[model samples]
Target: MRNNKEVNAVQATKTADYCLAIIRGRYPSLAPAEQKAAFFILEHPESAAEMTSVQLAAAAGVSESTVVKCCQRLGFTGFSQLKLALVRELATSREGAFGEVEPGDDVPTICDKIFTATLQAVEDTAKVLDPCEVALAAEAIFKARRIFFFGVGSSAVVAQDAQLKFMRIGMTAHSYLDTHAQLTQAALLAPDDAAVVITYSGRTREATDVIELARECGA
Candidate 1:
């Protein structure tokens, strides 16, 4: 039997992980309000902890209802409860906060700082890029008889790029944006085949369905 605080803590942990996963996978597809909420939480989590629903809504340029809804969607009871959980998460996670800039910084100086920050972001990303995972993916693709690429919107561009690269290398790769086309390809994918699901928001129902169908066909 967990107390309210304990239950809230557990929910917060789950919500934090869920939000991070969504931001990593489906950020590009987030609605404007959701995107703003996501970025605020990721970039300035400490501040997010102190914000009231109204203040946070103003910061994100969303309605208070949106803020409440976002909190509920993330598994918190409401804004206050979400803030409490955020505080706890921030205390435990050692992730660096994004540096803030004053409005007075000159353009060139700000540009240089932004450039340095971008480099740091790239370095951080590279630290987690496992070579073993790359090798495994390459092996899977190389040995598969066929490949289906799934993505939507901007991610669709990335999927198409992957398809083209594989095709240029003489692999049978197909990328689809339409529901019917994806369904057709997914239905045809076999146990000997593989599928590369590409979506920033791994939650896109249509794209995810295609990936699911591919697995159903034993890809």
Candidate 2:
């Protein structure tokens, strides 16, 4: 069993990682000043959580309004709300919130860590996902004349699996592992088609290109 200080430290680390993940997901779309503020928060989540809006702005070399705008862009109401969220996360985080396998771990330990990590991922996704948006996406897919799935790297494998499943359900679905092939398919997409772009980091160049082409084609 760990003492209070140790537990608090672990929770703070977990919260920081979670907050960083959110910021990173939104990094590509943020404005320059907002991105700078986000970068600072990513590098120093604990310190950012404790700092005032003005202090964080000075530290990130941005204006105070930029910090507040960054927080809002990150889905928070303001800097104060972002700070509150960080504090809440730190307080509510459980032990082993992010399970990691250590070297020389036995079979059972490895299995436990893997399973814990999976559960944590699912829970975190649930926390951020919007049910209304999911419903809209599902509706769009259902109404589409065809579906185009675009991805690269490991996400390409997932796109292929999605294609197979959609095909099994008697839907016209296409996915290509090659970047050129993906762009070609995207270019052929009609206005009635639906395109699903998958990327783990949300910053994959190939995935972005595919989405751009699909959108240009009115998919």
CA-lDDT, candidates in order: 0.71, 0.79
lDDT of 1 by residue, 47-66 (tens): 77788888888887888887
Using alpha carbons, what is the TM-score of model 2?
0.66
Worst 10 residues of 1 by lDDT: 17-26
TM-score of each: 0.56, 0.66
Model 2 scores worst on lDDT over the 10 consecutive residues at 91-100
After aligning candidate 1 to the native by TM-score, how far in Å is the CA of 82 from where it should be? 4.4
Note the clash tally of each candidate: 4, 0
Residue 83, model 1, lDDT? 76
lDDT of 2 by residue, 107-177 (tens): 99999879876775676676556565688889989999999888898999999999999999999998888
Q: Which runs in model 1 stand beyond 4 Å of their true positions?
A: 1-29, 39-44, 58-64, 72-85, 88-143, 152-154, 164-182, 203-206
Model 1 TM-score, 2 decimals: 0.56
Candidate 2 Cα outliers beyond 4 Å, as residue runs = 1-81, 91-95
Residue 4's lDDT within candidate 2 is: 80
Candidate 1: Cα lDDT at 4: 80
